[model samples]
Target: MTNGSPSESAISPGKPGQSTAVHVRDVTMDFGNGALAVSNASFELETGKFLTILGPSGSGKTTLLRMIAGFETPTSGEITVNGKPVDSAPPHRRSIGMVFQKLALFPHMTAAENIAFPLKMRRFNPKTIPGRVDEFLDLVKLGGYGNRRINELSGGQQQRVAIARALVFKPELLLLDEPLAALDVKLREEMQLEFRRIQHELGVTTINVTHDQREALVVSDDIIVMDGGRIQQHAKPVDLYRAPDNAFVAGFLGVASFINGHAVPGGLASGENFLSGTHAGDFADGTAVRGAVRAEQIRIAAEGGQLTACDTRLTGTVRDTIFEGERQLYVVATEEIPGITFRIYHHDPESFGLFEIGTRVMIGWNARDMKIFESRAS
Candidate 1:
């Protein structure tokens, strides 16, 4: 993932009297006696906060979302919404609204009709539906566009209509399954901000599932990173990015470089270097381990320093450089660790002016920045 910093908006905690919006406990689902689709997933989402399930394809994020929306049943476990157990609740009766990836708006209906569909289904009086429709259309910033057909509106406008329709009934919880995936990159980003704004205004608890890590980080109050049907880490976006619990979480969240080493008597031993750092847990001396470091934590040296002769120093030849607008990325390869590369972010190129290909350079990170993960037996 790119390491550039993005704009962050403040997240609001739920209101004082709001109840727990959704409680998932020991939720596990399997398919045809095969591998688990979701395993022992548990979390409580307070009312009015937006939570995101972030994972790659086949990671069970969509399945978990579907279960919460009552489209799929868990093989075992319990789900409660507003303190009421809902494992057997039907989709329409759960008081949850959903916006699907395809928008699913009826092409023939006007935006007002689409927004009123849910209220109409509940046999709301025809007189009441129009007022509620207008209220939601205005809430989503599409009050004047409600008379237009779904086909006439732009993609972003259509998305707004879909969201208005989902929320018109004032459901207790909202589920968004990749609602912005089909839009262009620029529109997708704009809609992320818009979605957050709407969530705040409506004060509805929301759960979104998406594969885009950047999107998750931008809009979610908390992120649940999943892999192979189990949650790898659950925390605020910044915490997950900075201090992932394991190698998978570290590698999946953002750009990271791993240093394979063993804890020796003095420090960590890898190739010709021995570096010192805090370990996650107690391990025997000479125990195999892997150290993780973020690209931004590494510093490039021009002349000489203590790292030059220590185990923390990694001498490599610059192999490639990528110039982003504000920062440059250097990919360096060392003889001691052939095929392994380190990525360093340079803010001021003139400080250590751009290095040409094949220029030998040494890179090092602070001992405190290193994270050691115990190597598992293969």
Candidate 2:
């Protein structure tokens, strides 16, 4: 139903059920005969869910989004929307809405006029345009500001207006390509929450492309982490963060330390030190493997423990220390492992605050906390 203003009812359509909204099957995109921009990428988008393509620069996220938007066609494979083949369909006919990095609002138009532009193109009744505009403005929380000029509104307000305008057409899918990237840090964060709220309220299927991991984790129901044009992992935010599939995935998500060790009778052996834990992958006895541990997982203890039965412990010297407001970070150089450095995160006084640079210390962690990956040969 239309609200007091045409913009008031400009809610994103509710999400559909388990039925797929967009499907990319074995899609690949290449420029001329050169390198591939998207290499055999494939994924399914559920109706009403938010899926984010996350990666570093040149990872082909934008190109993949463009393909979904009908701005660029895949070199091979098929794309379907709502069970219908859309590979040959033109953008306007595909029933989709897009918001770019730049808001792309008309400078000369009032907020109401800008929101009404899409409806006008659809040949909507002129008499009904005002009501629709008012409905959408209210929905975007800009109900009374319809008459304000584009330049008159703040950056955030302009963003809401752009969103309202795109939704005015009521497309089946929405594609946002880092729409908040241009805003200031605070504004970007605020907009991220606002967009998520709006998306959930409307339940429309969405595909967002961003290089910011935090942004992706905060806004997405499922995240696709990409590297070198290939998807490294697709999982819920918590799973990807806690249990990364590989060394690259582990390091990319946050700070980590890699330690090399050889498999022994009881556990893994590194020089004179042995760490006990269940092995993760297939590795024969005496085979060398690399173990990774997050900074927060490494525990620091005062020297001279009775070598009690613990997971793993190594004696080391505090090479450097840095105080980070709430947490203390220490770079320790160990005698059992030379040239190998360990980072420890200390937040409590009894745990981390007592350590100082040049102090002798012992670092240890539970075997379960350490992730062992198959070592690659040089």
Candidate 3:
């Protein structure tokens, strides 16, 4: 599949009596020398759902996706497709369609030819192939552009062709391998919408792998966050964003600031001040824990002006500010928190530098906004 040709599958209708599209149980992959690429991972995907495996580079997200795609066999556990074990099934025999990062369409072939390749390879009726190709070209909003060659088409158009080629055979499941990673920010975001639109329109069970957190949140019905070859958390996008299971997830999902302290009666105590927060892990009196608060959750104002609604308040000097076009990110340093800094996002892009570096400001957040997690060392 990485060699510019997909490991193709023939057309397969959904197996009756199975609502689950893919099931992975206790899957592990060892690459010798005590290297575990995937560690005891397990999950279930319902039919007609979009699941994204998201993580940073070398987090084994790609490896896990590959295992499910049948490119790499798991060292332990089983993967079932449509209620049947496919441990011995090769890539092309698993009723799965794959679109790779490279787009993998033939440069010499026209867009229509690229889309029609899978149908032809799978031995679909030659007469039906043309219509099927046209239907998908229209589905991807590239109807009349199919006559153009791969190089002649834009990057987004080529991606559409790859998606069309992969799905033209109507495989039971679709696998996306970071198909939008190479596009520029604007184009990548645009393709994310296109991907979601296509997935919803087709209602095909799909699994995608990517390191983009925004992409995961935008396109996935459910997401699996992986790190160090381990599955950290899996949940719907909203649930995962609002209720992270641990410190890593809380910090990973959003631009968050962390302050270390000992757990007090209701929240965390640093120095003589106590900051109220919601606790996610077991906390005893004086237990060391770190509290995480998203940047956007903290309200910032000129000292003591409009922060009466906040449960916790602090005065900090602006150490740095970044222009993010749509929002301004401020890094504030406060001495009251005992060697802690805070990041606050002001969405008013019109006021680019609300407070220049070294300006004093008051920052506050409600108790429910901060999440406290037990420190690993504790």
Candidate 2's error at 112, in angstroms? 2.5
- C-alpha lDDT (0 to 100) for residue 138 of candidate 1: 79
TM-score, per-candidate, Cα-based: 0.89, 0.86, 0.92
Model 1 pairs in collision: 274-311
How far is each candidate from the true structure, as Cα RMSD in Å?
6.3, 3.4, 4.6
Q: Among all windows of ten consecutive residues in candidate 2, which has the lowest summed lDDT?
A: 5-14
lDDT of each: 0.82, 0.81, 0.86
Candidate 2 error regions (>4 Å): 1-15, 32-34, 260-272, 276-289, 305-310, 348-354, 375-378
For model 1, residues 166-257, the per-residue Cα lDDT tens digits are 88777778899999989999999999999999887767789999988889999999899999999988999999887777777777876778
How far residue 60's Cα lies from its native spot in candidate 1, in Å, is: 0.7
Cα lDDT tens digits for candidate 2, 1-378:
434432244333433666788899998989775778888989998888899998888888898898888788889977887777775676666678888889899999999999999889888888888887887788789989999999999999999998888777777788899888889889889888887987877777889999888898899998888877778788888898888776666777767888888876556778877776556666788887777788898888779854354578889999898888678888999888787898878776545346778999888888777777667674
Sort the predicted structures by TM-score, highest score first: 3, 1, 2
Q: Give one clash count per candidate, in the order shown.
A: 1, 18, 0
Cα displacement (Å) at residue 21, model 1 = 1.8
For candidate 3, give the lDDT of residue 70: 83
Sort by lDDT, best first. Answer: 3, 1, 2
Model 3 agreement with the true structure over 3-43: per-residue lDDT tens digits: 11112222334532247888999999998857799999999
Error of 2 at 303 (Å): 3.3
